[model samples]
Target: MPKQNSIAITGAGIAGLSLAIRLRQTGHSVQIFEARPREASGEGAFLTLAPNGINALRALGLAERVSSLGIPTTGIEILNAAGRRLALLDEREAQRQAGAASITLRRADLLEALRQTASAQGVDIRYDHALIDIERKADGVTLRFGNGESAHAHWLAGCDGVWSRTRRLALPASPEPLYTGLTGTGGFLDCPHVPSSGGVLRLMFGESAFFGYIKAQEGPVFWFDSFTLDEETAIGRPDPAALAARTRAQHAGDAAPVRDIAAAVTSVPRAYPVFDMGHLPRWFDDRVVLLGDAAHAVSPHAGQGASMAIEDAVVLAACLTAYGAPSRAFRAYETLRRDRVEHIVRISRRRGAKKQAKGPVALFLRDLLLPLLLPFDAKTTQAVQRYRADLDPLVLPAA
Candidate 1:
C-alpha cells in the first residue's frame, strides 16, 4: 500500500486491532506494530465484557465472533472475609438496561481473536516492532520502530496504551500516568472440586486483600485479586511459580478456595502496578493522535478498559472518515470521548479504593454501610452498562 493511502497504528492490543479493522473495511491501508511476539498469549487473567463494550464490538462486526469465544457472566457476588453477603450486582438486569449481559473470557483469547480478524481483513500486523520515535512530515508522519524499520502514513493513531511512546514523542509536555499505589496478580485454576459460584463471580473482600473467582459450568475456575505494592517495590519480574507463592501468602487465611484456587493455578498470571490517567490536556499533535488506553488509562476495576477502547476505535474511525482533515477529525474525536472516559476513570478509582485493605474500624463501617448504599450503586452500574457507541455520522465539534 502506498503511503498516500495508508494509516499507521501503534500497539496491536484491543484498541489498535479494532481500529485497524474499522479503517480497513472503509478502504484505508492500516498497519499495526505490536511489541509482543506473534504468540500474543500469556496476557492477564480473564475480563468481563459489559454490554456497552459489546455494542462497540457490534459496530465493528465482531460482537458475534467475540461473544462466541466467551461465556455469559450473569452477575458479581460481593462478600466480606467473614463470609457475609454484601450485595449481588446481577448482570441479568443488563438485558433491560443495555440489551445484553456481560461475557467473561480470558483476556488473551480476546486479543488473539481480534488479531486474527484484523489479519484476515487485510490489515498488516507486524509483531515485535515496538514503536520508538516519530518524525514530522509535510503531509503525514514517519514512525520509527526499535527493529530499525520505518513506515510513513498519512496519519498515526496511538492505541499503544498508558505509557504510549506515540504520546511521549508527539506530546512531550503531557503529564505522566500516576500510579494508584495498587498492584495485583491473578491466575486461573482448573479445579472442579471447588464448589461452583452458581453463575456469578464470587468476590471476597478479604481482611488483608480482595479476591474474585467464578467456576465455569463444568469447566475451569476463573479468578483474580487486587493488592497494593510497597513504595519502591522490589518485585523484579518474578516467574509464575514465585508469583503464585506470593499471591497465596498475601491472601492467606481469607476463606475456602482463596487458598485452594491459589494452589491449583495453571494459567499464566499477570503482575503489575495499576495506573489511571483520566485527565490529559490534549490527545493529538498535528497528524499524530492518541486512542484508547493511550489517551485514558483507567483501572480494570471499572470493567470498562476494553469497552472504552473499542468505543474509541469506533468514534475515532468515524471522525476520520467523516471529517477528512486530521485537524478537524481529531478535535471532533476528543470532544466526543473526553468527558465520558474521564468520568469512568474517576469511578474506577473509587471502585479500587473500596477494595483497599482497611483497618478493623473501617471494615466495620464498610460492612454497616455497604447494604444501605447498595441501591445507589446498582443504579450506577446499570447506567455504565447502558452506554452505547451511538456516534452521529455528522459530528459537530463540542462547544
Candidate 2:
C-alpha cells in the first residue's frame, strides 16, 4: 500500500467510483464529487463487459455481483438483411484465452454495482457537487465545487464524462470533440418477438444504417441503430418515439429486424453523435489528473468504453498505490496509460467506419468479410483485453 493521502475524485460514474473503492481499500481517504444529485437510477440500455473489464471488477472484488446480472454469451452470430448467418465468433475460444466470458447486462446494473461497492468500501460520495475549478500548488491541490464548497487534497483525479470540466481546466487549448459522421440512437424495447434463450446478440448492417439488439434478463432487451447522417441532419435530443420514426424514414432499404425493433421501442430513445478526441499532451498537471472518458472518450463502435473505463480506474489506483506521492503517481499513470488509451481511441474510430460504411457493396463486405476475418480480428481484440494493471509495481520514496 502507498502512503495515505486525501484524494478527491470528480464524477461518480464507473471510473470514479471504482477508483474511489480501490484507493480507500489501500488505506487512502477518498471522496467522490458528482454533479448529479444522488446516484442515477435511470434504467440503462444494454452494455457488454469484456473480460478485461471483468478482470478489473474481479480485482475490485465485485465480480460475483456483475456476473449475477450478466447474460452469458454462447457465441455471437452475425446475420445479413435476409437473416442469413454470415459469420460466427468463437466465444468459447475467446473466453478460454481470457479466463472469463464476456458478459452483457443492463448499464444501470453495472453502475449500481460500482456505486454500492464504492459506498460499502467507505468512499465518501458527495452528489450534487459539480467541480468548478482547481488550484494546484507545489504540495497539493484545492478543488472548488459548484455548491460553494471546497476541499484540499494531496491529489485530485477527474473521471468526469466526455465533457469534463477538469479537462477544460487542465488543457484549455485542446480541440473540441469531433463527430465521426455517425449518430447512435439507442433504447430498450419489450419485444417478445425476438427469440430469447438469451442466445445470440444480433447485428444487421445495411446501406443507410446498422441495427443491433442484445437479449437481457427480466424481459426488457435493448437495441441501438447507427445511421449515417449528413451534416445538416440533426441528431439532437428529442422525443424517443419521434426520433424512432425519423430513423425509420432514414433507412429506405430491406429492413426487417431494424424496422421491427424501432417500432417496438416504447421508451424514448436517446440519440448522440459519436465523437472522440485524440490524446492530450498531458493527462496530469502537478497534483491533478484525468481518468476514463475524461482522459480518452473512445467511440462506442469499439464496444470497449466500459471496459476501458474500468481498466482506467484500476490502473489509475494502481499507479497511485505504486508511486505514493501525487506528482510521481500522476507521471507514471500518463506514461503507462497514454499510449494504450490513445491507440484504443483510434481503433474505435476505425471500427465505427466499418459499421458506418455506405452502399450495398460496402455493406456486403463489412457484414461478410469482417466475420470471416474474426480469426485475425480476435488477436486484436485479445491485445486490448489482456491488459494487466501494475498495482503492485515498485516505487521510489519521496525525495
Candidate 3:
C-alpha cells in the first residue's frame, strides 16, 4: 500500500473545495480551512461556467448535478448602445467541440455544490479558521489560524482569492492585485422588457458604459453593467441603491433593453471593482503552493476565472499523484498552468480595456472595430472553452 499524504487547503472557495475533492479521489487526506463562516459561502453574483469548466466538473462526476441547476446559454449577441445589433457568436459549434454547453449560475450555488460534494467524500472543512501565519519545517509546514489553532500537513495549497493571505505569507514580496479602473454592478430583474433573446447572452457596448444581460428560459433576468472610474472614485464601496442609480444614469438613453433591465431591478444591485494580478516569478515555495486566483486572477471580461481554477485543481491533483515528492508535484503543476493562465490574464485585460473605454475617440474606435473583429473573438472563445483536464489515471480507488 502507498503512504497516504495529508494536505491542507486554505480558502474553501471553488478552487479549494474542488482541489479537496480531487486530492481525496487521488487517495490523499485533505483538510480545508475557510476564513468566512460556512453560511457566507453562498453569497455572491452570478458567474458563467464555460465548456472547459463543465469538462472539469465532469471529471469529478459533477457536471450533470451543476447543469441541472444552471441556465444554459448557447450564444451571445453584441449590440450598440442604441440596441443596434453588432455581431452574434453562436456557441453551438464550440459546445460540440468541448462536449458540454456553457452555463451561468449564482456563485453561491456552485460553491454549495462543491462544498456538499467535498463534504460527502469526508474532507474536513473548518469554517471561521482564517489563516494568519505559517512556519515551514523540514518534514512539513505548520499553519496558524486567526482563532489561535494550529495544524501541520505534508503539503499546503493556497486556493484563496485575489486578496490571499497565503500568497502574502508564502511570497512576502509578491505583487498585489491591481485595480482595473472599472466598476461592475449587477442584480436580478423579475420584469425584464427585452425581446426573448433565444437564451443568448446580450452584451451592449453603450456610448459610455457596457451592459450585459441574459434571460433564462423560466427565471428572472440576470444583468450587469461596467464603466470606467478614476482611482479615487473607485476605491471605496458604494451603497447598492446609489450604485443602481449610478448605473441607470450611466446607461440612460443608450439602449432601451438595457434601460428596461436596469429599471426592473428591485433588489439592491451589488457592486465590485475589477482587479487582476500580474505574473509572479514563482507560485510555490518548498512544501507550499498557490492555486487559482491566488496565483493568477484574470478580469471577468474573459469569463474564465472559475473555469481556470477548476482546471488548476485537476492538474495539481494529477501532478501530486504522479510525483512522490510534494515539491516536485508543485513544480510540475506550476509549469503546466503558468503559461496558459498568464495568456488568459493578458487576453482578459485587453477585453476589459475595451469595455472600459471612456474617451469618445476610444469608444468610437471600439464600436467601429468590434463588429469586424467578431471572427477573431470567436476563435478566442474556442481556445478558452475547449480545454480538457486529463483525470482518468488519477481517479481515486474504490472504497
Candidate 4:
C-alpha cells in the first residue's frame, strides 16, 4: 500500500519540477523551492533534447507543448575550421533508429515549459527561496531556508544542482567539482547568414580545442570549448562581451564562421565550467535523497546532461510510485539510473578524449574509428530512448 507522505524538492530546474509533478500525481504532496525569484533571469543557454527526453516529457503530457517551442534538428555535420564539411551523420537513419526526432531550444524555454506544467498540476513552487541546510531524522527530514523559514517533510529530494546544499549536507566528503580543463562560452546572435534549411550541427575540431554551432530560432547560437592547461572557473559571472572577445582572440587561426558567431553575440554568453561529477556512494540515505546534477553531472561533450537530468526525474518518481516508500524507492531509482548514467560518463570521457586529439593524424584516426563505432553508439542510445518502467510494481514495500 502507498504511504501518505509530503515531499520537499529543492531546485526549480527540470529534474526537481518533473519529480514534483510525478510524485504529486502519485498522491504525494510536494513543495518546490528555487534560489532565483520568479522574475529572475534564468541560466541563459541552449540545449538539445534527445528522443528519450521528449518521450519522457510526452508521458507527462508536456511533449506537444515543449516540442512546439523548439526547432527540430535534422542532422549533424562535422566541419573543418574553413567551414568545409567533413563527416555527415545519416539524419533520416538516426531518426528512424531512435524512434523520434531530436529538438533543440533555448534552456530558458524548456524551464518555462516545465514550470508551467508543474504549476498547472498544483505543485507548489516557492521562488526566491534558497535551501540553506537539511536535517534528516529517523522519521523525516527538515529543510531550513534562506528566508528564515523551515519545512518538515517525510523526505527531501535535492534537485538543487552542482553546488547543492542538500548534497553537501548529506555527503560532506564528496569531491568538490573538478574542472575538466575546458571552458564553455556561448551566446545567441542575429546572424541571418547561416542557411536555415541546412540546419546541421557543425563541429570543428582542432588541437585540444573544438568549436560548434547550430541554427537557433532567435539566430545562430554558437559556442567555443578549449581544453587548456590554464584552468579557470567559468560559472556565475557573465560578461558576454569579454567572453566573446577572449574566445575570438584565442581561436583566430581556426575558423572564420566560428569567430564571426562569437563576435556577433552582444550579450555575455553563459560560461560553463566543464565538470564531470562521478557517481555518489549512495543516492539516498534515511529521509533525504539527491537527484539530477546534485547526484551526477556529466560533461557537455556528450550533449546529454539536461536530457539525463529529465530522465532521472521521471525515473526517480516512477520508482517512488512503485515502491511506495522513500528508502526502497530511492534504492530502486539508484539501481536503475546508475548503470545508464555511468555508461554516459564513460562514453562522454571517450568523446572528450577525441576532442583532445591533436592535428590531422588524430583526425584521420578518429574518422577511421568513429564510423565503425557509430552503429554501436547509435544502438546504445536506442536502448536508453526506449526505456520505460512501471511505477506501480516498484511501489510494493516490504511486507
Off by over 4 Å in 3: 1-4, 192-195, 232-235, 266-269, 390-399
Q: Global lDDT for candidate 3?
A: 0.84
Among all candidates shown, the one with the greatest lDDT: 3
For 1-399, candidate 3 gives per-residue lDDT tens digits of 112398999999999999999888978889999999978766667889998888888777899999887789899889888888888888898899888999988888899899899999999999999999988877788899999999888879999899999999999889999999888877677763456667699999887788998886658878888888776666666677777777777777776778877766544545677889987889998878999999998889989999989888998888887887888988888888887888889888988888867677877787789889878978977876777774442432121
> In model 2, which range of ten residues has the least summed lDDT?
390-399
For residues 1-399, what per-residue lDDT tens digits would candidate 2 score against the true structure? 212488888998888988888887778888898887774533346778877778778778887789788787656766666667777676677676776778888788888888888888888888888888888765677889888998887778898878889889877876667778887777767777765736467777654577777775456666777777654454456677777676666544535666666666554546777778775777887767888888888888777888878877777777776677777878887776777778778878877877767677877677768766866766777777665443332222110
Summarize candidate 1's per-residue lDDT along 1-399 as a digit string, tens digits: 336658999998889998998888778899888877877523677888888888778877888788887778788888898778888877686655677668888888888888888989999988889888888879788888889999889889999888898899999899998888777776567787888777788888886778888887787888887777764662455476666766777667766777677656543344777888947999997788899889999898878899889888888888887888888889999988887888789888988988884898888888888888977876776776676774352343231
Considering TM-score, where higher is better, how would the candidates rank from best to worst? 3, 1, 2, 4
Compute the lDDT of residue 175 as modeled in candidate 2: 64
- Residue-wise lDDT of candidate 4 within 124-194, one digit each (tens)? 99987888887766668778889999888888898988788888888787767666767676656667775
Q: After superposition, how far is residue 363 of candidate 3 from its true place, in Å?
A: 2.5
Candidate 4, lDDT over the whole model: 0.72
CA lDDT scores, all candidates in order: 0.80, 0.74, 0.84, 0.72
CA displacement after TM-score superposition, residue 58 of candidate 2 (Å): 1.1
Sliding window of 10 residues with minimal summed lDDT for model 4: 390-399
How well does each candidate superpose onto the true structure, as a TM-score? Answer: 0.94, 0.90, 0.94, 0.88
